[model samples]
Each structure stands twice: as C-alpha cells, then as structure tokens.
Target: MDHPLLLAFGLLLVVEGLFPLLAPQAWKDTFSRLIGLRDGQLRTIGLIGVALGVALLVSFS
Candidate 1:
C-alpha cells in the first residue's frame, strides 16, 4: 500500500478519536453510538473520508 493515505487515515483516526476523549460527556453519547457500528459501516465511512481528501488534493493539483 502507498503509505501517505494510510498515514493520513491513521492521523484522522487519532484526531477523531480524541474529540470524544477530550470533551467527554458532551460527545460521549454520539461517539458511543458510532463505536457500536458494524465493521463495514466504519470502513465505508473511512474510505469516504479518504476519497474526499484525495479528491481535494487532486483538484488542487
């Protein structure tokens, strides 16, 4: 796998995961629901995010 996208996704996961950790009660319930999603759902969402990011980069190029 080309690593830049994977690195970006890893960074995204850390930042996204931090939101709930930092805010605690405010975002806890919302994140908890997302945490329960089936594996496929999460993967789809992650792929969408990566695709969108790539689209943005390509557009600028």
Candidate 2:
C-alpha cells in the first residue's frame, strides 16, 4: 500500500518536473494566467475536483 503511494508521488514529481524542462516558456505563461484567477474561484474549483476524486475513490474502494 505504502509502495503504491510512493510510486504515485514519484510519478507526479517526474511529470511535473519534466514539464518545465520541456516547456519552460509555456509553463511560465500558463502559470501567469493561473495566478490571475481569483482566490475564491481557484479554491472552489480545487474543492470540486477534490470532492469528485474522493467520491470516485470511495465508491471504487
């Protein structure tokens, strides 16, 4: 169980890290646009995604 969690984390890190190296300018532009998003809006969107993910996981488990 722990091994799978660690593997997931490692995969996330690798994908996230590679994006910047592979597309630095695109990442910068995208992040700048993301930063323009209002805090409340971002939080709401994030919460919705988290909630959906949790529901799916719970149902699957």
Candidate 3:
C-alpha cells in the first residue's frame, strides 16, 4: 500500500492473469496469433499500450 511501484506491478499481475484464468483456450489462441505477427506489428501494439499507459498516468496523476 505504501509503495506505488510495487502496487502497480501487483495490479498488473492481476490484470494479466485474468484472461488466462477466465478463458485459457482463448488466451492461448490469442497468443498463437500474436506469435505469428510481424515484429513491426508487435512493436506497434506495444507502443500503443505504452502510449495509453502514459496518457492515463498523465491524466490521472
């Protein structure tokens, strides 16, 4: 509760766990498709996630 970085990482783990816990097959299928994506496509998706996270941090914090 006192450490923001630790709390954020913990929350991330919870969020990351949801898909597999809720639908393991779907999660596996999604990753299989993601594995087939080009490197640029994966980079773009990662960039989008980073951008969204930064935007949310700026807006909320």
CA displacement after TM-score superposition, residue 11 of candidate 2 (Å): 0.7
Candidate 2 is scored at a TM of: 0.68
| Candidate 1, backbone clash total | 0
Cα error, candidate 1, residue 24 (Å): 5.1
**What's each prediction's TM-score?**
0.55, 0.68, 0.96
> Candidate 2, after superposition: displacement of residue 23 in Å?
0.7
Tens digits of per-residue lDDT for model 3, 8-61: 999999999999999999999999999999999999999999999999999999
Q: Tell me how far the alpha carbon of residue 34 in candidate 1 is from the true structure, in angstroms, after superposition.
A: 1.2
Pairs of colliding residues, candidate 1? none
Better of 2 and 3 by TM-score: 3
lDDT of 2 by residue, 1-61 (tens): 6697798789879988998999999999989998999999899989998999789768987
Q: Which scores higher on lDDT, 1 or 3?
A: 3
- Which model scores highest in TM-score? 3
* Residue 17 lDDT (model 1): 85
Cα lDDT of candidate 2 equals: 0.89
